[model samples]
Target: MLKKDSLLKGTIILAAAALVVRFLGLFQRIPLDYMLGSIGQAAFNSANTIYLLLLTIATGGIPLSISKMISTRYALGRPDEAKRIYQAALMFGAVTGLLLATAMFVLAPVYERLSRVPDSAVSLQAIAPALLLFPIIAMMRGYFQGRQIMAAGGISQIMEQILRLIGGIGLAFIVLGLGWGDKYGAAAVAFGSVLGSIGAFSVMMWFARKLKKQDRDEESAIATDKAAKPSSKLPFRTIYREIFRTSIAAVVTAMTVQFVYFFDQSFFMRLTSVFYNHDTAIKVLAEYTNRAMGIAGIPPILAIALGASIIPVISSAYALKNMEEVQRQSSLVMRIVFFTGVPVALLLTVASYSVTGLLFKSPSGYDTVALLTAGAIFQITMMISNSILYGLNKPKQPMYHTFIGLGLKVVCSLALAPFLGVYGLIIGSSICFIVITLLNVRTINKEINLNILGNKWFAYLAAIAVPALAGWGTEYLVLNLTDAWANKVSYFIAAAVTSVIVGGLYLIMLAALRVITPEDVRSFPGPLRKVLTLVLKPFYKRAA
Candidate 1:
């Protein structure tokens, strides 16, 4: 069993590592975006999406299944049975990984033609080999997680991402330098995934060997103990059934956003064709993926990571039919996600163009970027609510809600396209997640009456709005007074100054509005609590 404090600490360690990996990912993405400009980027991203989908299919459910089965066996004091389960899972991973890798390699051209991108075929094939080892690595990571060794999984992830960045960008740059076109360069970058998987596999192997020895030692001591009884054998067939059962449910519940974005990638070019020639359509698609979607994707991922850390408590409470505890956990999670999400969504929406300039070299789809970033709050809500639903054992409900939202999303995009252009797609994205969030919330209320904000919801809205308006006005003045958009350097300056101003004001609002009380601060991790305490002390004293 995990130590009492280990759960929260482990969650924080994993979440922090996940965030760090995401931050490091930006280095690879930014360079790749510049190297493969509008058209090249569109093609590469399409291939990348396919890769992600396949990856989701290959590894998403299996890891959790492994973790669950292993934890159950070990909890029953069955080390030998746990070892058998791990061995069985490893065999499954090996077989599944081989099949998925072959499928990706063989289907590259079919997907390329469907998506209508030339280099996508090559990119798909380039990244196909990554699936071979990744599923196994995922299994190992899950085993360690089940064993309560969170650092192993975290370390492996960081190692994977770092190697991926180095190999992907470095190879792409070298390819471009060798006078290969961007098309092939994109393929080189795609192959970096293979290197990343190898690096992750290496790290996991070391941990697995160490853990295997520990398991053997424990088993030997048990065998020699007079009081110990021999462990009962678990049938591999029964274990496989259990694994598949959990795996299917997990995959179905987890695919909400990935499907939504897949719809975007599928329909984006066709939608843009209503207003642009072929080349321009490709350019707009590039900007939509790399700028709008790219920047907007960060907040929700991080928010979900944070919100999801408390979920085991929800699961535990719900399993015991403790509705009161369930409500408390759900409401607290939603509030924490909401509080953190507001500032990020606000900042990104207010300075979308400046951020585009600062990060992506220039603002291509200014409205689209702003609208999409604003939509991130909805995305964050959707992600957290879906997770909550899962904890409540309503996995199928989120999947059903997701499909309904996606159907409406398609209709919304078609209806709004004439007036909104790419912003229509952005709005459609928001609407998809919004509808899902609302439906999820409704179901959650029916199940547990989740009142996240009580009567203070309005105050929360005000907290978000005041700072956003202030930030907007500040950016407007900066834009008009100085030609920030005319140069990237000036845009960076404007964004930096505006961020500081908005951040300061938002902190003050947090105190004045009593948004971040000492009680709320105390709930956080020790390091974060200390920093937040120091930063908000003067404000608290002023309020007192």
Candidate 2:
């Protein structure tokens, strides 16, 4: 069984890796945005939404299902059964991948009509092949996670994103240089999705093989001891049934955000058309939703990686019926996620214009970006909460709440769009996740006396206030200081200075308030822990 210490370490590793991958993705998107402009980005995003939907459906919750099953069995001292379960899951994944890829490739034309973006058809076809490869990658990562070996998954993710950045941007520039127009350039970038999946799958397959060999060697070492009483495996049908049961709930919970975003893709242009011409509406919607989403996407990486790392650990604890451990870990994860999320959301909101201008070479959608970044607090909280629910075998609760949130999003967007324009859609996204997160938090309180709003919560709020105020001051100073400089230079200076000041103040405030202790420092990676330890030890001495 994986220890809580190992789980914490694993979460740090995954979170750090996720940060790197997100940075790479940010780099890729910045250049890609410059190349595609708002309209091409609109087409690309629309096609990408379809791909994400199919990808989510095709894999569903299979990875988490596999992880939960394996961890449960492994916790019960049934290694052989866990191995058999993984083998069967691999088969299921392969077939699902094949069918989903074929379906997407063949139905590209129909999807084009549905999305109302003709250029999306080419992008859709380019991204179709990835559906065939990613399921296997996900399954292997899940297996390693169940084994509490997070580095393999982290490594594979980094490798996948590296290849994606190189291949996608390289091809995009190649196409653009050849004078092929943004349509072809976007398609070329989409084709890189397949390459990225292939790279990740290859890396995961290598690790899976390595793990299999290690497992075999360990089994050989214990062969004599196990020979007397070998455990029997579950019936294939029974295993499949359990997998599907878990998967359906997981899929619903996991796909909530994607489905909501897909709703935006499907209706954004049409709804905006009520205010402007069709082409103009498309461009406006693209600027508001697509660009804003891209900028907003980066901050959730750490929460997502931590949530992913927590699932199998939490599942294993639940399988052992350790309610205390479950409660402790769940509360801790939520606190950590919230602590990271609050300042990020605040800083992003405060420096939205600078950040948008620096990264996208324009400040056109800064308001939307600011709103979405603030909404990320809800989004990140909901992600971690959803994982905890899944770990507790309460997946249906989150799934139901997500539907409520999605319904609210649709209704709010429809009612507010005509008057408020694209900002209405941003409102929908924010309110949807905030309501969903609150519901999830209430459920968690009942499940495990989390004390989410106790004195510690006040400390967290106080800690956040320091950085929020400092961030605004720094942004103002830098922007005013760089007024004589070029636009990009001014934005870069403001964003960079504000980021440093905000980050430093946030950490210091946490340390001073005693909200972050030595134990928390140990949860970070070695280098970070060292730096934090240095900053925190004086406080520790005073507290003692």
Candidate 3:
């Protein structure tokens, strides 16, 4: 069994790697936006939305389930059985990926028709081939993740993004500069996805081979008694069945959020097209979706990193039937999420226009971006709660909560879209997340018989709200003060400066109020705390 310290260390390393990849993602999107422009970006985003939905279905839940199965097997000291389980999972994932990819690839025309955009047919066709590559990449990802070698997963993700960035931007510029139509430029961008998937798959396979060799060497050194070793030749069919059974719950649970997105996109498209001219409606929807994808997606990337790490640790603890440890870890994860999520969400919301302009040069998406930033509070809360629910072996509860949110989103979006357009989608999503978060919280309270929403809840709000307000005020001041030089770059710089100042001041305020305890501060990963200290030293020194 891995020690707590070892697990914590692993979590920190994985989180760092995830953060790097997310940061790289931000840089990559900038060039992609230039390549695709507004309409093309929209087309690409739509295709990716479909791909993400399938991805969630294909491999989302498998990692969690595989992690649980492998960890449990390891804890029980059956390495060979664990290896068999891993192989079975890989085989199953491969087949699932291929089937899903094929279906989606073939259904591109159907989706184009449903989307109701003039050139969506061509764009969708351009993106259809990517479906063939996505599932294979996802299967490889799930396999390595199950082995708890997240470094491989992290490296593969970075490599994929790098290839996409280089190939997409390069081809996009070439096509556009060569006087090719937008469709061709978009197609070139989409082609990058194929290259990225191949790079990811290659890296993962290499890592898997190395890991397999290492495992073999370790096993050879051990004294093998018949009692100590399980049967090496388990039936592949039995192994496949076991993996499929274990993975189904995870797949459903993982796809919940994506399902929400699918519902939103479908209804949003229908409502907008019905209420307005098709071209105008498509442009509006494209703008909003791009904004959400660009800005709102960032926090989840970060949250997922931390939340993913929590799953295996919490699952193992629960498997040992240690309720105290489960509660402790769950609480820690939620608190850390709040501590980071609150400030980031607030900053994003406050500086939404500045960020949107700086990142994508698309001012039309600012309002939706702001809404999504605010909505992230609920998103992060729901994510942490859902992770805890799953970790505690209560998968159905999360699924139920997610569906409730999904239903609410559909109804709310339809009711509000005519009047509010993209903002309606944002409002609906926020309301859905709030409802789901509350539901999950209530469920946890009932199960554990603990009032989680006591004084600490208020403290979380204070920790987030105070900094957000200060940051907003400071940013507003800076923007007005620098009006003479308020170009995009200047505005972005001012916003960044204000964000840092406000965030620092907010941390100091939290410290003064003791909202975050000394123990809480200490529990942060050492490197992170060091960075935080460096950022806040001036303020703390003043206070001291």
Which candidate comes out best when scored by lDDT?
Answer: 2
The top-ranked prediction according to TM-score is: 1
TM-scores of the candidates are 0.92, 0.86, 0.87
Model 3 reaches what TM-score against the true structure? Answer: 0.87
Question: Ranking by TM-score, best first?
Answer: 1, 3, 2
In model 3, state the lDDT of residue 117: 42
Error of 3 at 300 (Å): 2.7
Candidate 2 residue lDDT tens string, 157-183: 898888887898899999999999888
Give the lowest summed-lDDT range of ten residues in model 3.
1-10
Predicted candidate 3 versus true structure: per-residue lDDT over 225-300, tens digit per residue: 8675557676878766766676676676577666766666656667765566766776676666666556776777
Off by over 4 Å in 3: 1-6, 71-87, 212-233, 274-276, 316-322, 449-453, 456-470, 523-544
Clashes of 1: 0
Global CA lDDT computed for model 2 = 0.80
As for TM-score, the candidate ahead, 2 or 3, is 3
Best-to-worst lDDT order: 2, 1, 3
Global lDDT of each candidate = 0.79, 0.80, 0.71
- True-structure lDDT of candidate 1: 0.79
**Position 261, candidate 1: lDDT:** 70
